[model samples]
Target: MSVRRPAAEVLQPKSFSFNEKNLLVVDTILSKYPKEKKASALLPLLDLAQRQNANWISTAAMKVISEILSLPLIKVLEVATFYTMFNLKPVGKNLLQVCTTTPCWLRGSDDIVSACKKKLGIDFGETTQDNKFTLLEVECLGACSNAPMVQINDYFYEDLNEDSMIKIIEDIQKGSKPKPGPQSKRTGSEPHNNRVKV
Candidate 1:
């Protein structure tokens, strides 16, 4: 992850060029802070833009954010480009952000990743031709308890195997949002715990 300069010091735009709602949202975010510290709301403002655009933030949107917050273009770019959550390119309707950090990798994230590649027919960072899904491998999502986990759109699936993983993908493809939690019934550690259970 890239180091973030505190939102306090960054420059912001004075006026936004997006939409009334977004401008309203930006206004709300700005209002939460003292009048002199509007720059502190950059993250939420950009997040609102990303959510409105489905999954990614566009360069134009960044420009609008810059203008709205009265920040320099490069400063806004610094925040937008540095975060993996901010997508410069188009992503699928459903984005699968797989956790490939060490714990996830050691457990079975690779298996889940492979299943996604086979089912979607697109490698990581690539979206399916049908525009239904995109696969992305990301670092620790702070879901280590559910080590082998994947975040689809805004939901998380943990303790996954090949079959369960496929089932979850199929569910998403069918427009069903699978409930977030462990795939297996076994209470946590039995699956990921490295210590002997004796």
Candidate 2:
């Protein structure tokens, strides 16, 4: 499948540079690889660039990465475009990645998706007007045991139903950080109804 990148004239930034802190991080990452094998640092550098550039990888940022690693620009672009984790366009502060794999689906992930869309007033692959949330349907986030989950940025909110999902979004909008993990009474992937003794 072809990946769609934003038009350069439309959304690309003029340039990108790592800040002092990230530059130090770059040096540390590069140090882990042999000087001749600097390209191995490409993924981490791209990740750093994305984090520094508001969670999206711009063309200019990719170019900067290529120059830093002494790699061809195409190599950087190929890696960036191939990874779903790399966003080509700007995203909101909270990236809501709903897992809709078979496990999640079986556990009512559809309701979670609907709740997010209605609460955020945006469909999948779209961001809210306030730029606080972007909703996307992703494959399994490896939390099948906690099926029907949504990953908000770096945190996972599992064991969700429609009401809990809506409340989580509302909490974020109100500038409150909802505790991450199972929304239900169960704890940390433990069996429901205390089926297993810990």
lDDT, candidate 1, residue 20? 75
Q: Estimate each model's TM-score.
A: 0.83, 0.93
Question: Candidate 2: misplaced stretches above 4 Å?
Answer: 1-10
Mind sharing the TM-score for model 1? 0.83
| RMSD in order of candidates | 7.5, 3.6
Best model number under TM-score: 2
Model 1: residues with Cα > 4 Å off, grouped in runs: 1-17, 186-198
lDDT of each: 0.78, 0.89
Candidate 2 on 1-198: residue-level lDDT in tens? Answer: 112233453467798889999999999999999999999999999999999988888889998999999999999999998988998888888999999999999999999988988888888877777788888999999999999999998899999999999999999989999999999998888778777655
Report the error of model 2 at residue 156, Å: 0.9
lDDT by residue (1-198, candidate 1, tens digit) is 112223344344343355777767777788899866777778888888888876666677788787777899789989987887886666788888888899999998889889988887878766677778877889998888877999987777888888999999888888888878788775554544455766
Q: Can you give the lDDT of residue 147 in candidate 2?
A: 92
